[model samples]
Structure formats: C-alpha cells, structure tokens
Target: MNARIRGIFEDAGVRGWMHAVSLDEPEASVELDADAVVPMASVYKLPLLAGFCRLVDLGELDPRERVTLEPSARTAGPTGLSAFADPVTLSLRDLALSMATVSDNASADALLDIVGLRRLAEILESFGLRRTWVRRGTAANLRDLQRRTGVDDPDAALAVLADNDRTDPVGVYEAANASAASARDLTLLLRRLWAGELLSASQTEFVKTTMHRQVFLNRLASGFPHDGVRVAGKTGTFGALRHEAGVVTLPGGAAFAIAVFTHAARGDFRQPRVDAAIGEAARVAVDVLR
Candidate 1:
C-alpha cells in the first residue's frame, strides 16, 4: 500500500505535499511534510461538529433545541439543507445533519454561529491536536477593514463574505487564513470517534451515522468500496489543498484510519492525477490494515 500510495503521489502531481496514517495499525504510514499546516477548508467542520456534540454531552445545549433558519442564514453552495426550502425551523441535531451529511454551507455557517469558533479551537486542543485552529473571521480581518468606520459588527463581515468572501467564524470565510492539521491528527480524530470516545456514546453514534450519510459520493467513499467496507470521513478542498480523512471498517472486520492531503495547484480536482493519488492511498491503507 505504501508503495502504491507513493506511486500515486508522483503520478497525480501532488504538488506541495502528501501525508497519511492508520489508526488501527500504527505501523502503516506515508507522508510529506507531515508536520506542515495547510489550509483545512471544510475539514474543520468535523471538529466543530464534534465539539458541539461534546457540549451536548455536558448538557449545555440541547441537540434538539429548535431554531429558525432565517433568509440571512442561507448561502450559495452544494446543499439540500440551505436550498429552496422556505423559512423553516429545525432542531440543532437536524442542523448538524445538514452541516455534515450534505456539506450545507448555510447550515455549517449557522452552526458556527451557535457553537462559537473559540470553543471549537479549544476542543481540538483538548483532543491533543497541536496544529489545528478554528479561528474566527472577525479576529482574522475585521479590525483593519473596520478602521475609520469606528464600528464593530461581527455579522457585517459574515454578511459580505462570499456574498461578496471573508468571515468571523466558519461561515464561508476562507477558513480564516488556512486552518489546518496533519493527516496523523486527522486519523487520530477518526480513530477516537470510531471507538465511541469523541462524545458521549449516543452523540458518537450520531456522528458516525452522519458520516455514513455523507453525500459527496466521491473521494475515499467511491474509491475504496470493497463489499462491506464502511467509510466514515470528512473531506476538505480549497486552492492548493484537497484532503479526505476517515475510518474504514473492512469486510473482514479490520478497521483503520486513513487521511490523504495534497497541495496540487495546477490539476483540476477531477484530473486523473488527483483521483488516482487519493484512490491509490486509500487502496494502500485497505491492504495494510485489512
């Protein structure tokens, strides 16, 4: 698998770097700049969702707490949750579904509003990740833009962002200047969740179920299907970065965590090099562990 994945990196033009690790089998691995911090993109949403579920475990917020999705909460992106649905209210749990299952930008954005970015950053820190950050957009770019206006509005930055690109939280703000983590850290996260350790047992189950319901239909899911292999993962994409991190339970009951991150700038995501690299890495992970 390592040789295959290595070949894939070369064949696919994985530009700046690549890295992968296994949770169930510690000895299985591959890397390039394994310690480097690149843009995380949507992968940050995983930690954010886990942190929110953690809050629920503490009884601080009800998973089913009802909230209304006003028009302002919507954003343009690939999502069934944020789409043409009329003004509707849903429980926090349902909102989480949108954020995870369908990659709904509005749902993810609104969840950030509810969970707060500081808490998410702290959650990763508590989980022993040294390089992960969930920075707020306002903290990232607001003060300079707000100069002379003598006004501070957190919502102002979020409103104009992508409606115009920038943020105060997770709401489509270019991830606040490159939030990132190593494949090793991401694998650790998946391993923990697979073991029902990230949140309370029930919430952990919810997280797992949400992962199983992922709608992307590509990446590791399509590439690594082997009869009963169950994939539960999160993928992130941005300029120069494409990543997928998750746990796979093989047909033989062996489970492993695999994460692949690349910094390919020239290749369109659909390019053979990109898919071949990702597919090859996952294929290697399966062979080593399963």
Candidate 2:
C-alpha cells in the first residue's frame, strides 16, 4: 500500500481493507487486510444479482416475468419503488436493474424472494465464496434495527443512529442478520464474473451493464475520472460502515476488480471524511495495480 493511502485511512480513524486484481493478469495485485471480514451492507446485492442471473441462465427463472408489490409488502427505503406510496409492477429484469443501479431496497427484497436466500448462498458456494452470505433481506435488517433500539419506526431507529446513544450501535449493526463478506472474497467474485467463469456470456453482460448504471459514484468512481476508464460499482452504506465493490475497466482493456470496506471509529452517518477515505484508498490500490 502507498504511504499516502495508509495515511488517508489512518487519519479518518476507520478500519479499511482493499483488494485489487487485474483481469488480464489476475496474479498481479495489491492487498491491504484484504481477508478482513466486514459488514457488506448493500454490497451483498452484487452476489444477489449474480444469483438471479444464474437462475436466468439455468431457465429456472425468467427475467421477463412481471411481479407486483405494494409499499407495505416491500422493504423500507428512500429510493426507487421503495419510496413510492402506491403499488408498483415491474419485470424481474427491471427489478434486478433497480437493485444494482439505485440500490433499491424494495427491488432487492422482491428479487430475493424470487431467487431465494438459500439459492443465493448456493450460487456463492458454487463460485467458491465460502465467507459471504446474506442472512435475510433489507426488511429484516430494518426489523433488526427496530428490535435493537426498542424503536418501532424506521425514522426513530435512524434518529437513534444519528444521536449516537445506547451502547455499541456498531455491535448492533454487526449483530443484525444483515449480509457480510470479506474484501478478498468480494474481489474474487468480481474476478470470476469478469473471467466468464460465473455466468453465461449474456447473463454476465446483463450484470456488468447494470452495475455500470449505478447512480452512486462518490466512492470507487471518484478515484478514477479519466476519459476512457469506466467504473461499474455498487455501494453499501449503513450506520458507520461504507463500502463499494466492482470492476474498474481501463481504456487499454485492463480491468481491476476492487473491493473497499470501511467502519468509522466514530459512528457518524454524515461523516464525509470516511467516504472520501474510501475513494482515496481505492484510488491508491487501483493506481498500484495499473
């Protein structure tokens, strides 16, 4: 790791790990505590997307199938269909797209219902990702927050998080049956996906193209702003944790699968410093690999 990169993370008072490997030369890479397990937050959606694609490839599920869901039946979140007050109907492919492009909670849970949690795990195991798993959906995470804080509402639970009171919010965040993964494991998953080892060609393209449409670009994308370098990433944010994992493709046909995960020393939801650190850390790792 670069000294400046180490300083960037150290100064932010956050625990971070990064792993980057080039698609053209998988053996060439950089790692900093890459094996450390951290809360994946929405980063779990990447694997869920893959699992959904696998089902599509196997003819077990149809991406064109339409499903309807009401707000009450879906997970509570502030984006996409989750934020709508009325019932919304969409194709399974569009739902997966919403989950990847906007990190839509409702879309994720709806797709999770179709893909099944056990099937998602089976897909990851087939890819050799032993340390990654999603215990439940986003709605279950919200319920866990309510249970831990003794608050029955999502806004109240968030207020609890913002106030930074009631012992060990981080502990509660980690203890919740949310998804989890190690940085190394996430990077490897991306590697396999890019190497044409995870899904069929068309299915893999669907996953990659959806990732390219992600609306959040403050983390991994912030690091690489060059004209021809394209970044397709998914970000995860909850409590003191912020993570972004995806593949960064350069103009020369070189691509690096990178995963950056962080937990702030101070549990502040508005901490921009930690977010910037994530970008800087990933920038350093990508530079080294490049």
Candidate 3:
C-alpha cells in the first residue's frame, strides 16, 4: 500500500507525506513520512479558526462584532477582500467564514490580528499540537518572500519562486520559519476537532460547516466524488508545496481524518496532476485504514 501511494505521488511529480486514521480509533492508521514538518501554506488558517472559536467561547471576543477593512490596509491576495478595490465591512464570524470558505488571506490576517500570535501558540499548545505553529500571517509572509528575493513586488517574488534553482524562501517553503506542521499532528487536530472536546457545540458546528463549504475541490475532495461520501478539507499551496488535511465521512457513518502534504518537482502555478495525486494518495491511505 505504501509503495502504491508513493508511485501515485511520483507519477504526479511530487513527493508526499500522508497520514490517514480512523477517527474513532486513531490507533488504526496508515502513514508515510507523516512526521515530516512541511509548510502549512493556507492550511494554517485551521488553527487560526480554532483560536477564533476559543476566544468566543471564553467571552473574550464577540463573533458578531463588525470590522471595516480598507482596501489599502488589507493583505495582498488573489481572493476575498484582498482582491476587492473598495473597503469591506463584515462581522468577525463572517470574516471567519470568508477565511475558511475561500482561504481568504485578508480575512485570515484580520483574524490573526484579533487573535495574537502568542495566544494562537497557546491554543495549539492547549490542544497538545506541539508540532504545529503559525509564526506570522500572510502579509508578513509575503513581505518576507519579497525581501528574500530582493524584489519590491510580491508578483516578482512569485516569479522568482517559479525558478527551481532558487533557494527555498524562508517563510514560504522552510518549515522552521513558516506556518508549518506534521501530517500526524494535522490528523490529530482534525480528530480532536471532530470529537468536539475543546470547543462549544455551536462553534464546532460553525467550523465544520465553514470547512464543508470550502470552494476549492481539486485536491482531497477530488478523491471522493460519491454523493454519500462527505469530505471537508483545507488546502495549502506555496511554490511546490501543496496540502490538504480534513475529515472524511462515509455513508455508513464511518469517519477518517487524513492529511496529505506534497512537494512537487516543478513549481508551475497550475499542477493539476499533483492536485489529483493528493486526492488519489489520500483515497489509497484511507482504503488501507479501512
């Protein structure tokens, strides 16, 4: 099974790290380099979401509080308020919704500001996720990328990233310097999230619903196309790195938590084969666990 999954990743021009476990019985599992720390990319938003919910549960934050984000002040990104030309106003909870559903960088950075980096680290520690940590938000990360590439523009930095010969950008691909986690740690987070042990019922449901509504379906969701098989995942992408970690529920009520992180051989912006392989490898691992 391991060999087969490796072949699938290799065929897609990527090397992968994966972990799939029965949510109800975590001991029943499948793994390959699951301990390897990799860049979290947008997947870091998962922990950010948890921190947001935690603050709400603690009465430290009001989810319905409105925030006005000016276009000039927002983070740079391809989606959400980051792409909009005009200022946008939304409730904290609605911002969280945008962050989860669209992997919106602007929304996420706003949430990060509300939930400080130190507090977020404490939340992760509370969850016993020692291997996971978000060092900074998207805006800081992009600035770091630009500085490393000696480019004034984020787009030029991205162009430099496309060159395979360039060094790994610190806050983008280097696990130690970026938002990063191991596959096993990610699966554990999903397991705990599904268990509803740390969060209130309403917040848990809110997160689950937001995750289920995520717009991108080319990675993990691609593996399970059946109407009866429900998949809720968060994907991450940076240069050659692509990842998705989520929970999959079968029609029979059996559930599994899986995390697949890959580093592709090429840095092309659109690597459909690598995306499909993420799903395929996940399906294979889940099959073995089943």
Q: What alpha-carbon RMSD in Å does predicted model 2 have with respect to the real structure? A: 1.7
Q: What is the C-alpha lDDT profile of model 2 across 4-119, one tens digit per residue?
A: 66688889898777787887788887777787777788898899999999999999999999999987788888898988999998899999999999999999999999999888
TM-score of each: 0.80, 0.95, 0.97
Please give the ranking of all candidate structures by lDDT, highest first, separated by commas: 3, 2, 1
Flag clash pairs in model 2: none
Model 1 worst lDDT run, 10 consecutive residues: 164-173
Global lDDT of each model? 0.66, 0.84, 0.89
TM-score of 1: 0.80
The TM-score measured for candidate 2 stands at: 0.95
lDDT of residue 5 for candidate 2: 64
Please give, for residues 1-290, the per-residue lDDT of candidate 3 as tens digits: 78998899889988899989998888988888999888888999988998899899999999999999998889988888889999899999999999988889999999999999999999889998989989988888888888887899987887788787776655567788888899999999889989998799999999899999998889998888887888998888877888998988889988999999999888778899999999898888778777
lDDT for model 2 comes to: 0.84
Please provide, for model 1 over 67-170, each residue's C-alpha lDDT reduced to its tens digit, 9 standing for 90 to 100.
Answer: 88776556544465557567778999888888888777667777888888887787777877777776642123344334422346634432343231322233
Query: How far in Å is the alpha carbon of 95 misplaced in model 1?
Result: 0.9
